[model samples]
Target: MARSETESERLKRIAILNARLPRTRAIAQGVLRDPKGRVLLCELSYKREWDLPGGVVDPGESPATCVEREIFEELGLSVTVGRLLAVNWLPPWRGWDDALLYLFDLGVHHAGELDPALYLRREIAGAHWRSIADAAAHVAPYTARMLEVAADAEHPLYLENSEPGRTR
Candidate 1:
């Protein structure tokens, strides 16, 4: 027969059980454009190519909040995350599990408005506004595709693995 458990023991048991449950990883990215229609990309200290301003969603946080939080943490820029731009599902790659990437529209800024020196965080090596063609060459393939779709999207797009076959 089992004896009654103490409150502390019960809490510990629940924590252990939670740790064993499967988890899904979600990332949020923001799309910002300059007055000249150049896309904003940040050079990460850990990666060779540039990426949008965002990061992984923390547990119990919504994707919208995650993007705003990540941008502030990464760029020191407080931005109102606007409409959802795209949702791309990524398969497992680089030894990481599959993840869903949420893209948010951050609207446009005038030329010379954003000063890299004033807002860039330590994790960012640099920030630049580049034409779509130039940004495509500097970002990942999936990112390039997302940019293309986002630029012309009249409404939010949902893609499966960044492919057109599945969109809603």
Candidate 2:
């Protein structure tokens, strides 16, 4: 027979159970377009191809907040993160654990809005605004898919393995 638990004991047990629940790493990426409708891609020093202007979501941080923070940190630009464009589930790849990527629309930017002399963080080698075709050539496979979906999506898309599918 099981003994009844006190209130404190029950709370502690609940906390333990919560702690043991599986967790997934999250990446928040921003989609920023130039006036000519080209997407912005950043070249990172650590990777061969370009990527969006965002990073891993910190613990206790919201996806939106994480994207905004990462963009500022990487590009030296303060951006307003808009509607969620896509949520993609990535299986473990390149030694990384499975992760959920949240892509948010950062809206379009005018040519004059960007300062040419802004110092990019050391992690970022350069940045460019390229057409979707050009962007696809420069970004990773998953990122390329996200850009394609975001460009045509009238509503948010849920993707699995970089393709649209039923959500788990």
Q: Which one wins on lDDT?
A: 2
Q: Against the unseen true structure, what C-alpha lDDT does each candidate score? A: 0.83, 0.85
Candidate 2's TM-score: 0.87
Backbone clash numbers for all candidates listed:
0, 0
> Which tens-of-lDDT digit does each residue in 1-168 have in candidate 1?
989999999999999988997666999999888878887898998878799889899989999999998877777677889899888888887788988999998888764655676655557887788988888889988888888877668888887666654523
Poorly placed runs, candidate 1 (over 4 Å): 1-21, 118-121, 165-168
Residue pairs clashing in model 1 are none
